[model samples]
Target: MTTPILLFLDINGVIDVEDTDVQGENLPQEYSTVYPVPGTKEFLQVIDSCSWIHPVWISTWGKQSQAWNKWAKTRCWPWAYPLDSDERHQALDLIGHGSDKYLAARWYSRDWQHRIVWIEDGFWLSSLYDSSMGAAVKWAENNSNVKLIDTAPTVK
Candidate 1:
């Protein structure tokens, strides 16, 4: 049997994004509006059809399991599994308080960085928490699989 692909997924800047005229950005970053990024439904349709792609919710937006699952179901977003607050907090402790999303995925994927496919926005962003963090993200980007989704121009 082939090894199934591990997909670590994020909510904001991905399926959800800064709403344009139709909607407004979530100031609190709660993403309550539920404006899906352009082509998100189509992308998820393809992803869900692929038996190999195993997507796991790795962002704080969906840290709450029930809400996240509900959101996924409402939008028909492949119904990815969500990491609860406890699991997310434990992973955060490993890398300290910061926005290094790849690190969080690392814990969830069980250090299977190279094999896992991470879909988030941080890798494409230029800012870095520290030299070490920058290096780590760089290393993961280079080694692990990543799809840097740019939701700059939201599709109306």
Candidate 2:
């Protein structure tokens, strides 16, 4: 049997960018649109076809859909689902942020025996997963599971 790998998914820098959309009364009009990075469809296809990769959405949508609901209405992704609220909450309680992309995957993964890889873009890159400080260099030096993949720019 193939081992299941947990994929922590991020929406913003990974697959989306901001656009002007009404949030609600007295709120800012900013929302995310489908800004699929290069090879996005193929990447998701691999996840769908591969039995070992399990995708868990770790976006700002983890707590509330926010603009994701709108985006989802327009974008179809049958291959992915977010970590449930309880799991997301637990990860947040542990790491103190719902967007703790790296830590959340480690703390709430359904299977630890399987490998975990995160496809994300955020402050973590410079902070080493520090939501509040900068220690990324030191953290990367110490962590064994982190892997970086290079990708092409989105087509305009």
Candidate 3:
């Protein structure tokens, strides 16, 4: 059997060109018109075909993740579970603004035995200032089970 792989996905620059930094905090309410990155369809297709890879949402959507879900539905993409718990989800500003995604994924997978694939645009956002961010980057680099894939704001 294939090993279970947790895919921690960030939507902003990973799946779409709408980087939170560029698009502002106010995301579009309607997703019907928004398009995804050029190769996103194929990428999603590979994830869909692989039963071992579990995709989880780790984007800036935070408490408003429902909006992301609505967007995913519009694109007919696979459902992505949130990495944040119900309590954390209630908190609006993520955990540490820039380092939230990386930190959350690290904390969430602490006890898990599954392999992890973290895809984020701002994975190293505060690495220089945040020790935890720097540590997380080091950990991902050294750990074979953890793979960090950085995406550009444009996704291509």
Give the number of the best model, judged by TM-score.
Answer: 3
> Across residues 81-132, which tens digit of lDDT does each residue of candidate 3 receive?
3444663453324344324455577656656697999887755664656765
What is the model-wide C-alpha lDDT for candidate 3?
0.61
lDDT, each prediction: 0.55, 0.49, 0.61
Model 1 earns a TM-score of 0.59
Q: Which stretches of candidate 3 lie over 4 Å from their true place?
A: 18-29, 63-98, 129-132, 153-156
Q: Estimated TM-score per prediction?
A: 0.59, 0.53, 0.63
Which candidate comes out best when scored by lDDT? 3
Lowest lDDT 10-residue stretch of candidate 1: 72-81
- Point out where model 1 deviates above 4 Å: 1-3, 21-31, 65-100, 111-114, 124-136, 141-156
The sequence of per-residue lDDT tens digits that candidate 2 reaches over residues 1-156 is: 976766666666675543345222211236423454455456656665666776666665654433443333323322223556686676667655433444455565534555666665544343544544233223334655544331224334
lDDT of 1 by residue, 1-156 (tens): 656777767776667765664453332326455666666656666676777777666666544423544433433333233445786677677755534454565556665533566666555343343453354355456764644443334334
Q: Please give the ranking of all candidate structures by TM-score, highest first, separated by commas.
A: 3, 1, 2
